[model samples]
Target: MAQAMLLSLRRISRSFGGIQALDNVSLDIAKGDVIGLVGDNGAGKSTLIKVLAGAHDPTSGDVILEGRPQKLSPPAEAQRLGIETVYQDLSLIGTFTAAENFFLGREIAIGRGPALLRWIRRKSMGDTAMRGLEELNIDIPGIRSKPVDRMSGGQRQLVAIARGAFWGHKLLLLDEPTAALGVRESREVLDLIKRLGAQGLTIVMVTHNLDHLWQVCNRVVVMRRGRKAADLASSATNMEDVVAYITGAKEPMTPRPATTEAGA
Candidate 1:
């Protein structure tokens, strides 16, 4: 049986003034698949992610979700569709606790009407956040009381991932999640990603770490100079081939087996 397509970028293109950031790029991402997006500095990897994230509207293209056309021009629209992004900044308020950061802007209101009468349901939010962490089998000590800035980098990243997992129903976009971590911390984050994948979370992770991609990604997409250079199955390609694609040393060939949906 064919795996269902979760998201598709159809002939997407983005331009700023005369410079093209993305040039008619297209990609099909299947449900429950982990995709590693790789590229050099000038590549459109970040631009592509922002397009999907609703941070940047594509100059020309369509975003298809589950066979339906979706206009993801605004960030709110993406959130309404259960798509969430965890940027490199972690986006957590340093002064806030893990639970507080988990429910950041979208707080749970207890009352139905006016702002004066409606109160923030802090306890409810904390309980729900705790439950979510527990469900993901993630352990973060002092999540309810300790501030996020006081936590380790790995712990903070995990909190961010947990928040995304809790709210994101369809897709999770992670940008350089393990970039600032130590060796052990990086492994921990990678393991958490693998666990999420196992539980059927569709993830698009942007990373320069080829070894990390080999460990968690089912498919790797390489981009260069505003275009998609190659897409290859992790099991069928190596770091050298991926590097070659990024550096434009070799042309992209048809992906072997095309997609990883069957094994995804």
Candidate 2:
């Protein structure tokens, strides 16, 4: 049986002055889907993801989530609607502990009367962050106290991902998640991605790594020069085919017309 659709991008397009970043791209995301968005540097992959992340508003098109049109803009709106984006930079404060970074803006506070009089509930926040990590089977020793800068690259990436997973109830957008990690670290991050997908989070990952994509993504969407070139099942397509789509060496396949008998 087909999974129900979770989100849809209807003829999405984005432009920067005269340059078109995305042109009439449409895509459907099902519940619990791990979609890999791949393309060359100027292929509009980042633009499309930014549109979805609400970092960039589409010049045209609608973002439909759970059958309703969404006005995802200025980042916060998208966050409120359960869409979280983890950029390649990881976006963690180097001086802050994992728990502190986890609840950066949405800090837990204790006290009643006025906001200024309230004290930040550090213990509760740390405990909650630890629990969230544990639930995801992420083992980060001293995550509540260790500064993100002191941690390894993979650990910091995991922390960023964990924060996104904890807050994003609907969709998780990852941009080059393993772009800057060692082999083992990349493997760990990929494993975590699989776990997140298995737990029913719809994921849209923008990556150039076909190996990682094959391991974790169910669907692959390729873009070329600001337009969607192909969308294929990762299990069904090979790396060569995907690379062909990415480099524009091979064109997207189209269905052939049905043929009747010669003399019918």
Candidate 3:
């Protein structure tokens, strides 16, 4: 049996005034697959990610989620549809505890009837947040009430990922997840990504590290000057070839023998 496509971009294009960030780029993302989106600076990688995350609406073309067209307008809408993103900033409030950060905008509320009658369920929120992190096999000592600012870089990244896992029922997009991390921290993040994939969560990670891609990604999509330069299976392509595509040293090609879960 063939693998099912979870998301599809058909002739997607986005422009910023006179600059075209993405141009007629078509791609398909399979269910339960970890995809690496790689490109040089200003290669439209971030733009494509924003388009998928509902942070940017394409100027032309369609975004098909599960075979149906969707006009994803706001980031909230994307989250509602089970698509979550963890950008480079992580977006966690430094002064906020892990639980607080986890339920930043979507806090648990109790009581009913009048708006004033209801209150934020603090205890329930902490319990649920801890439970969610544990479910993802993320081990963070004193995570429940600790301020994210006090945690190490790796711990913070884990918290961000834990938050995404708690809400991401379908897909998770990570942008430069390990960009600022040390060696050990980077390894931990990569391991967390692999664990998420093993649990059947589809993930799209944007990174410049080809080594990291080989660690977890099932397939890689290379972007060059606002186009889909290369779509190759991780097992079928090497770092040299990927770098070549990113630098425009070689022409784009769709390499074969992809993972069983990747139909592309």
Candidate 4:
């Protein structure tokens, strides 16, 4: 028998001012799944991420987490529901140390009373941060306290991922994580993403890199004109199909489950 889905979006719709960003889109993401969402510039890929991450409320539709309906009014609400988003051009504090940035706005502290509260537990955060970085194979030279100002760009992005992976990341949404990275750096980031997914974190990556998608994702979700064009099993699909979808050479085809529903 098939297992219950972990997340589902129902009749989702969104718009910005007068522009229709998403048009009654819907999908499901199950546990231990990695979905690669691909589309053109204005195909609503980023907009969908923001909606799922709680950065933007959908004009309509509800996000179901753990099979329970949820209203994602803000990013904090999404995080509370174990949803994390790692976005391109929106990672790390260039001025803070890696350890500092790791616990930014979310420090791990030790205290008993309100008046007798203790100082910041640097050692605790540092230790955990070190373990996370090691797991990701992110080389930060010396200690985990090394400042981001001294670290490489790739390191910065890796740290951001490690931060999310260290906490509530049951459903991770990665938007162009390697968009501006060097070849080697991009691989490092992609490897970390895979490592996280291997740990049973359901991940959705919005990337333009077909090779990376083929390498990491179990399924692919292609969008066109703000609607889902295809949701194909990676092994059952081909480059020709994806290219055809991207260029509109092929008409959009819904997933097989949707077809079965109509027949039923």
Position 122, candidate 1: lDDT: 84
Model 2, residue 246: what's the lDDT? Answer: 91
lDDT by residue for model 1 (1-264), tens: 377889888788999999999987888888998999999986999999898888999999888899899988697788789889999994799999999999987888888777778799888988988998999888888888999999999999999988988888889999999999999999989999999999999999999999999999999999999888898789998999999999989886553323433334
lDDT of every predicted structure (CA atoms): 0.89, 0.89, 0.88, 0.81
Residue 202 error, candidate 1, Å: 0.3
lDDT of 4 by residue, 1-264 (tens): 165578878778898899988887887887888899998889988888888889999998877777789887689888888888887866678777788788876777877556347467888878877887887677777446567878777877888878777765678888888888899988888888888878888889999989889888998988887877888889999978997887778998853336224423
Q: List all candidate RMSDs to the true structure.
A: 2.9, 4.9, 3.0, 2.7
lDDT of 3 by residue, 170-205 (tens): 999999999989999999999999999999999999
Over 27-100, each residue of candidate 2 has an lDDT whose tens digit, in order, gives 88888999999999999999998988899999998888888898889899999999999999948999999999
lDDT of 4: 0.81
- lDDT score for candidate 2 against the true structure: 0.89
List candidate 3 stretches off by more than 4 Å.
112-117, 254-264
**Candidate 4 lowest-lDDT run of ten:** 255-264
Order the candidates by TM-score, highest first: 1, 3, 2, 4
What is residue 208's positional error in candidate 4, in angstroms? Answer: 1.1
Which clashing pairs does model 3 show?
none
Q: Assess the local accuracy of residue 15 in candidate 2 as a C-alpha lDDT between 0 and 100.
A: 91
lDDT of 1 at 172: 92
Error of 3 at 95 (Å): 0.9
